[model samples]
Target: MHQNPSMADIKVIIPAFNEGDSITKVIEEVPDFVSEIIVVNNNSTDDTFEKAKKAGATVLTETRKGYGHACLCGLHYIDKRSKTPDIVVFIDGDYSDYPEDMEKVVAPILNENIDFVVGARKKELREPGAMTPQQVFGNWLATFLMRLFFAAKYTDLGPFRAIKYKKLKELQMEDKTYGWTVEMQLKALRKKLTYKEVPVRYKKRIGVSKVSGTVKGTIFAGVKILGWIFKYSIR
Candidate 1:
């Protein structure tokens, strides 16, 4: 929080996977204050790429087919830019999150000089069926473990989050799959970065969830999340 950046330098990165049905809506809803919207298509078999581009977003493709891979691709693109962004906000492409709420997501970094901010989909604000039972349990378990092991105060591993660009690179984020979100949170804690959570509204996604909608996905995600938590605990 040493530097205060203008809203024009705030950029957004969205990782989309077969989200053609909701890509445009997600892109359109992002606040006008954002400087650029970069969408990384995660090997989508649908028209997510074309639609996002048509919606006037800078679109890139990552054929690795993982959430973390897509996010890393977007970060790579920004790193090579002539003028890097001051802040980077990440959101899902499924349209489950309120894109307009990005103002609050990035507010901590912008207004209060906080290092990181996550949009907590508070239970009261989440629509019925927006989160699967497994997802709820997984988030609870992950945050609970972090609190127990590190005295951390995180509530949810929510995807809608904002972070200082420099702080993000300092994390050296490497998880290329289900463990991405938790990896960021844990690294932030280990590094002792200032962070906060803002409750945000959530709704049902336009299409089925790739991770939470299937047994395999749910199990893999759970294992990855817990693995990160335990590994950090031992350290």
Candidate 2:
């Protein structure tokens, strides 16, 4: 087992919407050395907030109802704190990602001082049906555009990512919906932040994905992602 680095101040932010069933498992699996786990309950009608709090997470509520909105809320919460963490990690509330591999996701930043690290869900590491066909095609299309436009090496806009808190703030992230992940990557490229990808395991999530499972959600997400890519490409 790789030991957690004691010196690094790491905080994890989870944006959840009606993820009560899988929130606790996600929190419980987080490595112990993490300084804090902040679960942003994104207007979940269910008991997501309660379950996360019960699991010992510092839960916050974001009534705005967007993935970026919830993540921004967590960032605001951290910004208000007297002691800022060295690194911030963003992961899903669903149990699709292996929380235990957080150590690996943050390793490049912790050891090599990389500005950002993305936990790439490589095909070999992902379980069957873990990603929908739309999700797969979307990732491929987005990354291909990124490579063509910016000479970026990003393969997946995976949410399980880590970045230095200072660099993250420097990016001035403003996406409030499906474009959040790609916006970060594009901005990181624009700012010339050193980044690395670490292949990680992925499993089927406990519940249906709010974004990829529904037709409307998938279409909106695709449009938003493509919009960001084109907007940045022209700049």
Candidate 3:
């Protein structure tokens, strides 16, 4: 069993795109045990950056508009930090995820020697219409494909996740779009990393989802997710 480390070393990375209304709430709800909160504003045309900064989160700007790009920007900032965190958590800035449940998300890693954990937004725990039909279908299809191809047991491609900083670097994540979450899961499988999922609560976001709220965003996301799965399956 891994030594239970102080939760103080935990850092949070929130990939925000135009989440002006919800960023502050998201940042504030994060548990006090966390060390640093990093929010990557993905070319927002609103006051997202200013609000996040004012909310006491270390904010960075990623002009390139993609979830993965914003996440990569946050990771890059952490890479330059002098003291590396023991665990890094990724949550959305849209306030859809319960930030307080972070303790549960990182528990296995801190106590069970697990290398990674993804917050599974259980259908029962999610608010009505929290996840679009396409999102639900896409998650099922992607995870089903992973199981069929790799015998991997995964349920949700949830954004609220935790991973050891060292193991995260080992994955060499490179997805710059919708493929981000699946790419991490796929690479973790390829590396045979110990992982688990903890159920997390989900609610409707404060603003319209750029991806699930629009037809174009939904189609692109579906294609990107499928493309990643097929590409890795062939490897």
Best by TM-score: 2
* Each prediction's whole-model lDDT (CA): 0.94, 0.95, 0.93
lDDT of 2: 0.95
lDDT of 1 by residue, 1-235 (tens): 4333444499999999999999999999999888999999999999999999999999999999889999999999999999998899999999999998988888788878899999999999999999999999999999999999999999999999999999999999999999999999999999999999999999999999999999999999999999999999898
lDDT of 2 by residue, 93-118 (tens): 99999999998999888778799999
Model 3, residue 203: displacement in angstroms?
0.7
Q: Per-prediction TM-score, please?
A: 0.97, 0.98, 0.97
lDDT of 2 at 28: 99
Which wins on TM-score, candidate 2 or candidate 3? 2
Q: Please, what are the lDDT tens digits per residue for candidate 3 over residues 29-94? A: 999889899999999999999999999999999999999999999999999999999899999999
TM-score of 3: 0.97
Candidate 2, residue 80: how far the Cα is off, in Å? 0.6
Q: Which pairs, if any, clash in model 2?
A: none
Looking at model 3, residue 40 earns an lDDT score of 98
Model 1 earns a TM-score of 0.97
